[model samples]
Target chain A: MDKNLEKKVINYGEAIYEATYQEMQRDNNVFAYGLGADDPKGHYGTTKDLHLKFGKNRCFDTPLSEDGMTGVGIGAAMAGLRPIFIHQRMDFLLLCMNQIVNMASKMRYISSGEHCVPLVIRVAIGRSWGQGAQHSQALQSFFMHIPGLKVIAPTTPHDAKGGLIASIRDNNPVIYIEHRMLYKNAGYVPTNSFEIEIGKGRVLKDGNDITIVGVSHTVEDSLRASELLKSVGVNAEVIDPISLSPIDYEIIRNSVMKTKKLLVVDNGWTRCGFSSEIITDVAINCEKITCERLGFADCPCPTTPSLEKHFYPNPSSIAKLANRMCGGNIDWSPPEVVQHEILSFKGPF
Target chain B: MKNQFDIKKAYYLFLLIRKSEEKIIELYNSDKIKSPVHLSIGQEAIAVGVSLALSKSDIIFSNYRGHAHFIAREANLDKMWAELYGKSRGTARGKGGSMHLNDISKNFMPTSAIVTSAIPEAVGYAFALKYKKKNSVVICYHGEGATDEGVFWESLNFASLHDLPIIFICENNRYAIYSHQNTRSINDPIVSRAISFGIDAERISGNSTEEFFKATIRCKEKIKNNSKPQLLECMTSRWQDHVGVTQPELSKEEENNIKKAIKHDDLKNLENKLSKDEVLHIKKRVNKEIEHAIKFAEASDFPRSSELLENVYY
Candidate 1:
């Protein structure tokens, strides 16, 4: 359970695999399935030794049917198998809406807790790979909006491993999101297997200038911004709310109280994004935040590297905002806010 | 163990489907059971035959037109009617209407709506069986229209390549919605396509109970004992329109022709083997069972709204 004992700088993808493998070793009911896992190269080599070690029954390949496989996971979970389903790309999850939303999410409520479908669905969000609009979207919030689903996006190796282990052992269906870029990003993880409780958020770094909330790949940008802000004498505290659903609002609120200003760095699109919910919550519950700047990929993420850099929020953009907000010239009014009122019907005044 | 199947029980099951749907039709027009119904009136033999071949452990995935299939699987008629009436006590806690009926405890999964949807699920169930090295088989029931989905071909390929024990039952009710077999496909012979999958297949009269059972017996033998995956195309007819409550678009003469095929004598052909009293007793018993089911359903209360969110997760 100690995080310092394990090797540092391990790929988040490999860490997730190790975590899942350890869980599988602990329980015979734990199994994994998806495309490329059975292949020799194994899609980023996340599931390299799984098939050889666990045999084909535990580590199996599936035909290209996400809906069917998702349902199979649901049924298997009902039959006492802790199954983990993998969708190579996030967009492919659209095909399995009925399975995820209708069957998996609602099974517990529909069955009156007679049975729990404890299935884990892992998907990758690739932005810089030039996957274009269809393949590059970071749409984890879509599933997060679902009430019954427990959603998690672990940015570092430690959280990736710990979150996966927790999800496999949890008594509810979990949607595990991993970023394509963070797959190779390494961090220190515990040697012995352990579980990270789902729905609890972690504060990566503590400071007092401004609270920078980020998730998945954006966590790296937030940490980078924290470094840049520190160089400029503006201390920025970074919070990585790893689990998206059942989010630890307490940690977020506590961070906001110290900072007094909030910046949401998201990898998803801007409009109706996860950032919107954070901003709305801050507006309602906590002190009025200065420059609630939501840094997201500018447009539909382009496949070309040159265009994608502009799409995703870089350290420069986050640091610039952090410096500006800390400097006290903060304009919190969004563009949609009207500058002047045009009266079509003026009766009272 | 030689004749693991009981023919008398099979015949009784067939009579159950027939009597149940007939009563359902009577109740539908009389406004007692008020919901859109797809009565498997004439298609009882197919469900009965398919279910007879199935062990209690074997899984069956049925269609939206699945009253007979549910009854054939021995699902409680009271809960089924409760579901139709939108009572919380229904099979799906009143959430699933007629189309998305499922009783997992009984090993019957029916997606009462969504055409061609459950086929791939059945295939996946079969794949899971193979993955676990279980000697169980999955029986999938769909109309000829389901063949149009890409999942059908994909499932067929997966089943054949893996040698999974799955019986793909094409309950060819002659029509899908309003379109006849000719309108839906170029050829009416659905079984011919199954041969291309390099699997044993057949086409039998779905209306004939004895013939349907014989075909299913042969297919079940191939699926279970021989470890061979197969498909059985039952050329049956829907006694009612595409939906049961609505009047069929067929002309009076055309409707009568379909009804003629559903006469009591159509089943009485096998009655010579039994004495007059025995045949009469079977009919009387079936009619009594139908009356009891209706009474039970009528007495059942609607499902409480609290149960609506009970089965959404897990």
Candidate 2:
């Protein structure tokens, strides 16, 4: 890191807005559009003032036609325009699966490299406050199972800005998943434009007793868990696998090799989910490694706060699991840490 | 409304598509061409007329039955034949086969196998053209069955709302695979659906190449002048089964309708305007081209096994 480089504390949503604003200013062919792109909220402030800065043609609102609008984005990308398509919720991505999985993902191969879909699909994952089953989902695993798409979920503001810029410049289509809970969480982001490599992982905290890998918002929870683990004398290593598809397996493999124990905390379901994939890959590559996975229980997301609290894995639950994997006492429960994002969120948007 | 030279050129294109598809039927049993083919034997005039009306720079997006549209654009016949034969030198390097054919140099965008999939893409392409202030327009081709898909109406709404420069051509052949339009849709005309979406639309009855050509010219002018999309519901007949070379079995009334359609062939109508020597010259020229394309495809090699994983990503 350069000491002289300028940096500012910005939230994840603002960072994304900055990336879109900068990229649209940098390239004439790049445009952003979705259902509420020009609305006052601007897709939870990720697309704020973009329509004013870039005009309606470049940054506009589209009809409530997910499949058709997705195809439109693919077509525009094939026609030498970079399209940033914003979906307010990741759950709605199911409606455009045909366009995403069949059309955009296969365009390059079906065209034999003659056409490339340089498209960015920005979808936010909602949690808390009765979002229910349809509105809340972290479906990165669905995209990771696909062959042609590049899927990334950045936890911090710095990674969000850099990853979005990289996604916009990537020739192939990219599925960018943002956790709405991480939007208001601020971090030190560089003032200048930058791009973090898509298929790379970052170690938030280095330790030797156990390796705890997290996806999307779970990365933040895992970090808080590391603090609790340290108090118990079980120094844990926390890893953030930023890119789900084309995952940085080598990073997780190395961490598991050194620690000899792995615990994957996913923001989605464990069955046929990203955690299962990580555990399977690690088991195949590493020897004498103990692996456990944690995620939402195999059921629809409940709306009540009490059921939702038990439904999602938090810092205390993560630390308890990590301690159990390390052969430490699992009976001890740490004080619950209330997340500010959850308290601040007043959704049903 | 076109000149004599243009009309003759359109005739040549119409005959070329017809003969090329007929050649496909002739060679399909040989087992050399590995992909399933959807022939447009009786629907060539829609493609030819629209292709003739558009400028060289204009783009086209077509459905699975795209042989006519691909041929009407005067794209490389060698590549098209090679693609059908699954040759390495094909337009898509033998990856897409028949359902997905594209010639970027000719501005004919890749065709889609799924119904209503390419409709929104054409609108998107037209949107890009409008945003960039490009004078080029886009023509999207699909069957009447595509209108049954919800995405079709969604695309129409978006195109009309955005005022994109595009023309949606629905070749209503009265059948989707084995199901007739009567079984599939109600008594409402497909053009009325487009009109309901606030697009200027009309139905072009019969497979008249000149009428389709004139209508496309008028639509092109209107789209460019108003920067809005239009629709043309072209009523035609499918001469064969939806897939493969076999002729479909039809009822006596359907058979009589086919007989009437053959009697009023657009090719024959244009042939009457030309001298016998000119018709012979055009036939010889097209026949020679088709033979060369076949030879090129047969002589081309299959894609290497190592190339199976290639082009899966950028």
Q: If you superpose only chain B onto the true chain B, what TM-score does each candidate give? A: 0.89, 0.97
Output the lDDT of residue A153, model 1: 93
Docking class of 1: acceptable
Prediction 1 global C-alpha lDDT = 0.74
Which candidate has the highest TM-score of all? Answer: 2
| Per-residue lDDT of candidate 2, residues B140-250 (tens digit) | 999999988999999999999988988999999989998988898898899887998999998999799888988899898888688568999999999999999998999
**Could you list the iRMS of every candidate?**
3.3, 0.8
User: Which candidate tops DockQ?
Assistant: 2
Where does candidate 1 stray beyond 4 Å?
A: A1-9, A65-68, A71-75, A106-116, A257-260, A282-298, A326-349, B1-8, B29-35, B110-112, B251-257, B263-276
The local distance difference test score of each candidate is: 0.74, 0.91
| Residue pairs in collision within model 2 | none
iRMSD value for model 1 = 3.3
